[model samples]
Target: MRRNQRQAALVCVTNQYSCERLILAGKNLALSEGLELKVLCVQPPEYASGSYLAEIEYLFAVSRRAGAEMIVYYRDDPVRAAVTFIHANRIAHIVLGGVPDPAGSAF
Candidate 1:
């Protein structure tokens, strides 16, 4: 990011579906304001069912349509990766999904 440029929003979407939702919201925000969106996705094990790649492609499409940049990462430490992205991109704000509590299924 340049010094005279406006900061972009860093969105941490948990899954492919959530990424779509976040992209929509981010686009709306960007449209209302003079800012861009930086969509970021983080997943455990980095790859699962090839969904990560699909999500990245989806994000890219959304970003291209919205005139924004997409940054997706599949890693073990999602939060850390997101933080790194935020710092690297000089993101102004962070939009994140809720984290579910750790629990087991009933017998």
Candidate 2:
């Protein structure tokens, strides 16, 4: 990718905690590619009752230290929200956690 492009490396987290690794990965990838780092979390509206506020704040701090901004989107369809965010932010790289399903389960 060109250095002058407005591209970003996005780290997608599923919850408010356990995101340090993702953030670090995004930071390293962004630094190597000359891109900006971004952190994203998508959750259902019901989970927005502030129950995980502290954890979210902590993740925000981690992201800040990693030179990335953490953004949270409350939506029923996480895939759609993430897609929109990617398009809006001109994301060039994405880092996320997942495990293979031997049975090919579908969400």
Candidate 3:
């Protein structure tokens, strides 16, 4: 794919240890669709210090190993930040973790 292509699979995550799965899911989806893979972490400014920093660094390394670049955004509203990133990056697909429901919902 060309470097200037806008379509990408965006994996959005919080400060959770289970984010590796999300990153891999995004990578697989991007591969299948011939799109770029991207990982995004949105956190508040309060969590910018201490252990959170270390966890972010680890996750960044994981993202790189998966052939994706991780982007970190410190914002008061995570949803807003994710939306901004989705638009700015021209994300075609989003990989997010949530509670599984027996009644499936449309994407």
Question: Residue 66: error of model 3 in Å?
Answer: 0.8
Clashing pairs in 3: none
Cα lDDT of model 3 by residue, 1-107, tens digit: 44486688999887777788889888889999998899999888888775587778888988999899899988899889888777677688999898667688654
- Per-residue C-alpha lDDT of model 1 across residues 17-89, encoded as one tens digit per residue: 5567677777777667667777776777747557467656777787678677765566788779877777666
Which tens-of-lDDT digit does each residue in 2-83 have in candidate 2?
Answer: 4465789999986646778889988999999999899999989998998778888888889999999889988999999999
RMSD (Cα, Å) of candidate 2? 4.9
Error of 2 at 44 (Å): 0.6
Top-scoring candidate (lDDT): 2
Which candidate, 1 or 3, would have the higher lDDT against the true structure? 3
Candidate 1 lDDT at 86 equals: 71
Model 1's alpha-carbon lDDT is 0.69
TM-score of each: 0.70, 0.84, 0.84
Is 1 or 3 the stronger prediction by TM-score? Answer: 3
Q: Residue 47 of candidate 1: its Cα lDDT?
A: 74
Q: Quote model 3's TM-score.
A: 0.84
Separate clash counts for every candidate: 0, 0, 0
lDDT of each: 0.69, 0.87, 0.85
